[model samples]
Target: MSRFVDIRIDPAIVRRAARGDARAHEIIYRAFSAPVYSIGLRFTRVPAHAEDLTQETFVEVMRSIGSFRGEAPLGSWIRRIAISKALMLLRSAWQSRGQQLDEGWEDFTPQRGQDGNAAPDATIDLDSALAQLPPVGRTVVWLHDVEGFTHREIAALMGKTESFSKSQLSRAYQRLRPMLQVDEEELADSKTTAGTVLGSC
Candidate 1:
């Protein structure tokens, strides 16, 4: 018998999907497609590869859903699948056809401090700057800042040292900060000017 599931039954849906329930499987797929795609892109940095990972990830997820114990959030479960898919692709590329990666993006260390508390207006939208980082640096920063993983966890996941994770975060910030050349004082001044103009008008 096929079981219909709402988002509330995420765990049940996962279980049933693992057992091949078509309806529950659809719910699971729709729930995690965007995050799987976005994270796949982050890992692979190729749009086409990301698309493939998204599909492959869902397939893997469905295959393994019954084993999911709900120990972590559903999203985390799906993310693990996506990361695994991307890494598998990387491995296959290396083994089958040999792949070359630029080494210049490595050996980066952040010149900035690790204190999360930068001054007011300190948080810069450095998405573009992040794109310029070496893929490893960007991955470290995204996993740390965006995904909220600890250095130890990231090191474990990437097979690097905690110090390497810290250094990558630093390098990513240094490369990013220059792109956000505006100072806190400048941002404050602009805000004040805008406020004054709006107040007068």
Candidate 2:
């Protein structure tokens, strides 16, 4: 008979990690790496930058562990760190490329349907849609949709007014709408062609 190992939740693990116990550090690192990595990827399109952000996130988490008072789950704490680090990396990259922070996307209002749902024919290849967005737009969409942050919260996180954050999100949707529509049409055409070929045979 095979034996099942029982896993336990221990506050001591966190404490030990804060105290620099290598084994405890490993345990914490493994537990939160995926969530951090996924969050980082949402912020950065490049794989190498995302991976580096993930590692840097963990380092920050480890360094701050001693100050954690257990107000929120460790996973959430780590995620916050990851988001902050990814944004920092993005800002640095933007500065290096000599891009101005003020993009005029705010003037572009998204066309919303009557029921307030995305258009039925609209489809977006998630990665491509996101990649085409400006940094502020991409961050707003990812933070709101993927990470489940409210516009108000996102505003606070990004150090922008709520109106600005809302604008950013709206512009992101507007920019993506056309691309999504095109994707849907292509998919429909492909499906129709495939069906016709099958029926003729």
Candidate 3:
């Protein structure tokens, strides 16, 4: 499991939510909506699809809240739900298009030192660069780096082999390296900002 910044939600609210209290549900939504939507957007890159995923995630959370044992923070639980829903949507989309999970690796072969045609600016926005990657490449990178899922976990989630996850992540880094050439300070700043924003929820 990924380690998230510890942001405490009152146990009483979770208890109320498990009991099907509508007001408690509303509170939970407000607390988690931003991070959930952000994850959806990162995965789908479509505002409408992200919206749908966010809504679906909350619905599932509400339905399953009674099983939550307070073993982890509420936000972490909600995040797992959001990731599952987003992956389901992606799988459905791929299947509808007759695309196999491992069908397109040839297209993603790294152009050695390719900069993704990034601008000459000294700094690049990580999120913007990520948005430009192929969907599978972007997803694997996000799951492994941002979400801290091990390659085995990511493989299980995507219904693929661990080697596939490793390869995809390698290709993703090859694609991303040139577009996001930040210094250590800049990298730390981005991580801090993301953590703060997500933790705020």
Candidate 4:
């Protein structure tokens, strides 16, 4: 999925966009909007804030399209803009609380799955599980795993050290492992039960 999003677009369309062709601009916007908004939501965990960031990202994209060399995929360029805008919002919010961004990590306990059951394995919802993570943890996991950003890239985006991104990703995986293991065990049990029933029949 990440590879698909990072696929290169036609240079002609980009040139047309850089020249202020409205149709070309719209095409680019329509193609990249979902992924951009997804990054926003994953980072902010708020639909409204995500929408605002998406708009801001596109605005920046349009303004800077003239300078967009074909060195990288247009989607990659837009993703950087989206990440920058989202990080700006996060930084502002943290500052408003008179808090330092380098503060210690807070302990995160995985919440029950959407089914209100202790065994999250019964209902394996990746998005639900990801959403349950704290903002910093969720951003690290999504950027590293979903968006295919390197730990160093993520650290630069978050204005933290590479070690911070690595540590946060490690913590997120630690919390997610048990929840995912439960689902694997459940699948094995179901297959065994099915085999036994067939044998009895």
lDDT of each: 0.61, 0.66, 0.73, 0.72
Tens-digit per-residue lDDT, 1-201, candidate 2: 000012233689999999999999999887777666766666776777778988998888889999988786666677778878887787677778776444735444444457775455445344545555777787877676555577888877766788987887766665775655554344234233222322122
Query: Residue 134: error of model 2 in Å?
Result: 1.5
Off by over 4 Å in 4: 1-8, 102-107, 113-117, 182-201
User: How do the candidates rank by lDDT, highest first?
Assistant: 3, 4, 2, 1
Report the Cα lDDT for candidate 3: 0.73
Off by over 4 Å in 3: 1-5, 104-117, 181-201
Off by over 4 Å in 2: 1-9, 104-124, 182-201
Residue clash pairs of candidate 3: none
Quote each prediction's TM-score.
0.69, 0.73, 0.80, 0.78
Candidate 2 TM-score, C-alpha based: 0.73
Per-residue accuracy of model 1 over 8-125 as CA lDDT, tens digit each: 4446666778779999888877776766777777667788988988999887887777788888677776776676677566546644644432243544433343554333333444
| Model 1 misplaced stretches (Cα beyond 4 Å) | 1-9, 87-102, 106-125, 182-201
Clashing pairs in 2: none
Clashes of each: 2, 0, 0, 0
- Which candidate gets the maximum lDDT versus the true structure? 3
Reference-based lDDT, residue 119, model 2: 52
